[model samples]
Target: MSKFAKAGVAKKVMDEARKPQNQQKIKSAISNFTNKNKGGGTGAKPR
Candidate 1:
């Protein structure tokens, strides 16, 4: 949906894509996985 020819449609699509529920679900899933993997050396500095 290119905004050049259809601004309203593009705006609607982008708005839906940026919804709170969708963003929260994505962030929650990432955090859940990250917490599960919190341990020795997933992203830690070597000693």
Candidate 2:
């Protein structure tokens, strides 16, 4: 796609992300992802 098309898509995404509900959803998703990865360990077995 052209640069203009990319810019338009980015604008639309920014507008959608500016909404209160969308912001909350994004925050919740990030929080859940971080929580899920917290204290994760490598796959190595204990000696």
Model 1 Cα lDDT, one tens digit per residue, 1-47: 56576988788778876999888887898999988788666676767
Candidate that would win on TM-score: 2
Q: What tens digits encode model 2's per-residue C-alpha lDDT throughout 17-45? A: 99999999999999998887675684456
Model 2 scores a C-alpha lDDT of 0.91
How good is model 2 by TM-score?
Answer: 0.74
Model 1 CA RMSD to the hidden true structure, in angstroms: 6.0
User: Residue 19 deviation, candidate 2, in Å?
Assistant: 0.5
Residue 12 lDDT (model 2): 100
**Model 1 lDDT-worst window of ten:** 38-47
Structural RMSD, model 2: 4.0
At residue 18, candidate 1 shows an lDDT of 99
